[model samples]
Target chain A: MNEELKHYNDRAENLILNHLESGNVSKMIKDASIYSIQAGGKRFRPYLVFATLKSFGLDPAAGLSAAGAIEMIHTYSLIHDDLPAMDDDNYRRGQLTNHKVHGEAVAILAGDNLLTESFNVLAEDESLPADIRIQLVQVVSRAAGQSGMIGGQMLDIEAEGKNITMDELVMIHRHKTGKLIVAPIESAAIIAAADDETKALLLRFAEYLGILFQIRDDILDVEGDMSVTGKLSGSDARKEKVTYVSTYGLNGAKEQLELLKDDAEEILENLSSKLDTDELYSVLQMFAVREQ
Target chain B: MNEELKHYNDRAENLILNHLESGNVSKMIKDASIYSIQAGGKRFRPYLVFATLKSFGLDPAAGLSAAGAIEMIHTYSLIHDDLPAMDDDNYRRGQLTNHKVHGEAVAILAGDNLLTESFNVLAEDESLPADIRIQLVQVVSRAAGQSGMIGGQMLDIEAEGKNITMDELVMIHRHKTGKLIVAPIESAAIIAAADDETKALLLRFAEYLGILFQIRDDILDVEGDMSVTGKLSGSDARKEKVTYVSTYGLNGAKEQLELLKDDAEEILENLSSKLDTDELYSVLQMFAVREQ
Candidate 1:
């Protein structure tokens, strides 16, 4: 990662950890909930939240709780996604998955707790106006709920071992991953009280970035090795899952990824005054040619 | 059920079915999501939401969306709680559970969709004030999430087959069931813009009613037969789960139920000017002497 992105990631991680630890709940489930998030991964979603806030020349501090809230939602999805009834993955991010370590029942509850606690955190965030907090809850729930990530997941599961169309593939990624990636940017807009035009611009920028991120992920799944990626290479192919790489092949996928990167850069350039385009550009560059 | 409560129940059911059927989504998972909620349960929680609103002299129509949202959350919990990894029950309310009918993955997704959709419905409620809608999302999330129902569920799972105290049992039930029960009443208060003092009184009233409801459930679990209850008797015992009956015995549980009922009646009496205590009292009486 670039230096600025790394800084945002580190900051986000610290803020999220502090917030999770300070949650008022009984010890046992609290510990399990904390444990679910403590398994460190790139704090990418949260980074976007703070990054968007910073772009608006606002203090990112107020956005941290919301950032953490998004991460909590993201983490809960992963925990549930890794359940025995779902992907059944025993490992994630080079460690035992939540259900493996916490037991399936506790893991499920932990996921439930994290998902529930996320709204509590957002709702109780005193820094933002009540209206803004309400908007955050409203928008975030839509992105994380049926019409977004979870819906995408259901589609993904059903699409297994099938010949899915390009449109279907795009729909899957858009709902599954794109909506959440867009959530933080939209959340930042809500918090900053950005105008509709700016919100649209930010959303457009996020859409490009989301597609780019996923296509690169598909590319990496094919090309990246286990030692560096910390996960199995070609697993998507092994599962016969249709992805950007599966549909367009490596060269086409790379070409599409470049197009998305350029698209994001163009949007960022247009909104240069309203946002910190330089930081976003660098992040885009990283994802555009990421090796792992 | 009595005439008024029965009327509210039917209204809640109709509103919820219309709302669920009207949701715009892709076909397959949407159907599954609808299926999860179409089981024709008693619509008790939604009834409380409308009944509470009616007591406050507000049109129950204003509360329909919020009432439906609460039922969505409740149905989602039942779907997840019946997962093979959880309680693993095949039948609920004399019908196959969501997983049993729709397969595990879809069941899980249906639960996720309902939970997420509940928030969406609340956030978009046109009848209520924006602030009230937001408050509903916050409070409902807390009640349904980790610190409330989900937390209690974890505690219940951990306490299985263990000797537990009355305090522990109460704690579990309060968190698991009581909070969600209290949520609808609290929501009515928010929508009605009741004073803090009134809110406190109603919450106290709800707390007593919640405990009473749970104690009655425990009593029915032991004493009521399948023909009346539409569920297995002694199932709690078969699971070796601790309950009010298990902790206090049959006679003591009945005595405790009486105390809670009296307590609720007293609070209801104090708030008669602000609410329709006659209806509240009748509901309490029904719960107190309910055979199923």
Candidate 2:
């Protein structure tokens, strides 16, 4: 990660850890909830929240709660997705998956707790106005709920072991992965109170980044080592789940990644005339080529 | 149920059904979510929301979103609690539990969707001011999350098969069953914009009702028929789970229930001087004598 992006990531991490530590939950639940969070991923979603805030000439600190909230949502989704009934992965970020470390019952509750608390973090953020907090809840819930991430996940599960169309693939990723990516940026736009045009442009940029991020993930599953990726290589293939690489060849998937990167870059160029684009550009670069 | 209570219940049910039908989710998820919801449990929590609103002389419709939201949260908790890794019940409300009908994966996703959408319902309700909606979100999230419902669930699971004391049992029920019970009333108080004095009294009243409800449930498990309760009698004994009956004995638990009912009625008596308490009294009566 770039130095600036790393700084934002660390700040978001601190905010999340602090919030988790201060909650008056049961000891076991608190431990289980904190374990997966502290295991640490790229914090990519949070970085988008902070970067988008900076692009609007707003202090990134203004996006801290939102950044923390989105990361918690992301982490909770991962924990649930790794359940035995879902992906059944034993590892994440090179550590034991939540259920593997804690029992499945605790893992499920921890995920529930995290998902429930994400909205609280936003709703109780005294730093933001009540209207903004309400908007954050609205956007985040819509993105996380059935019509968004969860809906996409259902589609993906139904499509497993089948040859799905490219459009279907896009639709699945758009909701499953795209909504969350879009939500953080959209949340930052709400926090910054950006105009419709800028918000639309940012959303468009996030959509491209979402596709780009997924394609790169497919590519990594094929080419990257488990040591670096922190996920078992070729697990998607083993599960027979369709992906960008499965639908398009590896080379074709890489080509698609390039096109999405270009599209996102163009949006950043257009946005540059109005706001700082350097941090966003770094995020785009990270998405385009992140090894993990 | 009383005629007036039934009217409020039907209104809350319509709001929930309409909201569920209108969501843009996948077909399978929609079916799974709607199936459990449509299975028809008494809308008791929603009644508290509506009744509390009525107690403050607010239109019951004003609490519609909050009523629906709390019921959705309550429903989600029940679905998750019935999962194989948890209580593993095959039936709820005289029908197949969510996991028994839909696969575990879909059941889990359905519960998640419900929980997520519960907040959306509150946040997007145009009738309430943003500040009130924000407060609703904060209170509901706190009540549903780790420090409240989920936290208490953890304690209950930990206490299973153990000969727990009265204090420990109260602590567990206070969190597990109590918080959610209080949240709806608290949400209604926020919606009605009740003064601190009234709100505190309502909260206290709700706390007593929560314990009373749990005690009655325990008594019913031992004395009521499955035909009436829609649950297998002695299932709690089979699991060796601690309950009010297990701790206080049947007669002792009934005595405790009466005490709580009296305490709650006393609060209502105090509140009656300022506002209507008829609907609230009905709720308390139902809790005290409910066969199911």
Candidate 3:
């Protein structure tokens, strides 16, 4: 990864790990939560938070709490999703999944702990004003709650082994993955106190980025090496779950990714006159071509 | 239930049910969440919120959002606790548990949905000022998260079939059940803007009430009817899990309950000179001699 990306990644990791370590919770739960957290992911969502803030000429450090909170939410979702009752995966990120390491009950509780503590993290952030903190909580809860990520997950599970239409597939991914991806950028906007118009443009840019992220994910699932991707290739195909690749063939999915990249570029271009777009362009490039 | 108690119960029910029914989530999650919410419990925690607010001479309705949010957290914990990997119970409140009705995956998602949305409810509540709402989020999250209810639950699961000391048992119950029970009363104190001393005294009263509540629960498990309690009779003993009854003799447990009741009453008596303690007394009475 580039030095700038590594900086955001390290900051988010330190913030989350420090918070988890200092808590007075049960030792077992604390260990389980920290285990999955320290398991490596790219910290893509935190990058969006930092990059968006930098785009607005604000210090990226201002986005640290929001970045950490979003990453915690992301990590918790992965823990629950890997449970035997859910996706039943034994490996994630080339390591034993949470349930495989901890017992199922502990994994579930660890996920619960992370999810519950995320809101507390935002609420207790002394750097932000009370009102801004509340807004962050509101945005995050809505994105992760029934009408958002959970809702999408329910839809995905329901649609498994059945042929779903492209629109239906998009709807599911939009809810399941899109909302959370949008959350970090939107939170950055709120922190920057961007005007309504800038916020809307950033939101549109985020939507394209979310779809771009998923299409790239689907492509990676088909073409990625297990050593690099840290996932079982073609696992989605094995489950008979519909995806961008399934809906629009592999080549078609790649084509759709290109279109999304172009659209994202245009949105950033529109915002360039008002704000620095260098960091945002780097974020878009990472999303478009990330191998894992 | 008395007329006044019934009123608090009804208001809390309306607030929760209305909020659940009005969401734009997927049908499956919405149905599962509403199913658990509609399953009847005593609405005891909500009663604490309303009763505490009423004690301070504020409109009990002023406590509606906090009351609803706390109840949601309580219900989510119940749903998760009843999962097959956890207690594996098939019934709660005389109805099939969430997992039994909706399957394990949906039940897990539903529990997550309710938990995530709970913060949204408090954050979006315009009735309270922004700072107060933020405070509610912090308190509820802390009480429900790792250091509170979830932590207690982990300790309980860990202690199963093991010989544990009385202090260890107390510590587990304090984290698992005690923190959540204290949350509503502490929330009420915050809402009423009670003085620091008043808040500390009420916290002490809540601590006593939590132990009183657990002792009564242990007694109920030993000698209650399934029809009334909506749980299998003697299930605790059947599981061979330690409880107050198992540590102390049944008679000794009963003595402890009376002592706690008296202690709770004395705290109320002390507060009576400054505030209307009538509703609080009713709450204490309900905790003391309730049959179901």
User: Order of all candidates by lDDT, from best down to worst?
Assistant: 3, 2, 1
Q: What class would a CAPRI assessor give candidate 1's docking? A: medium
Task: Please report, as a residue range, the 10-residue window in candidate 1 chain B with the lowest summed lDDT.
Answer: B19-28
Interface RMSD of 2: 0.9
Two-chain DockQ for each candidate model:
0.60, 0.85, 0.85
lDDT of each: 0.81, 0.89, 0.89
DockQ of 2: 0.85
C-alpha TM-score for every candidate = 0.94, 0.97, 0.97
The runs of at least 3 residues in candidate 2 whose Cα sits more than 4 Å from the true structure, single-residue gaps closed, are none
**Which pairs, if any, clash in model 3?**
B152-B176
lDDT of 2 by residue, A9-118 (tens): 88888877777777674788889999999988888888888888878888888888888888999999999999999888898776899999898999999999999989
Tell me which residue pairs clash in candidate 1: none
True contacts kept of each: 0.59, 0.91, 0.90
> Could you give the C-alpha RMSD of every candidate to the true structure, in order shown?
2.2, 1.6, 1.5
- lDDT at A209, model 1: 86
| Residue A48 local lDDT, model 2 | 89
**For model 3, how does the per-residue alpha-carbon lDDT over B1-292 read when each residue is reduced to its tens digit?**
4577568778877877777776675888889999998997888898898889888998888888888899999999999999999989998876899999999999999999889989999999988898999999999999999889998998888887788898999999888989988999999999999998889889999988888889999999988877788767788888787788998889999999988889888988888877898888888888877778
> Candidate 1's residue-wise lDDT over B170-226, tens digit each?
898888889888998888888888889889998998888888988999999999988
Each candidate's interface RMSD, rounded to one decimal? 1.9, 0.9, 0.9
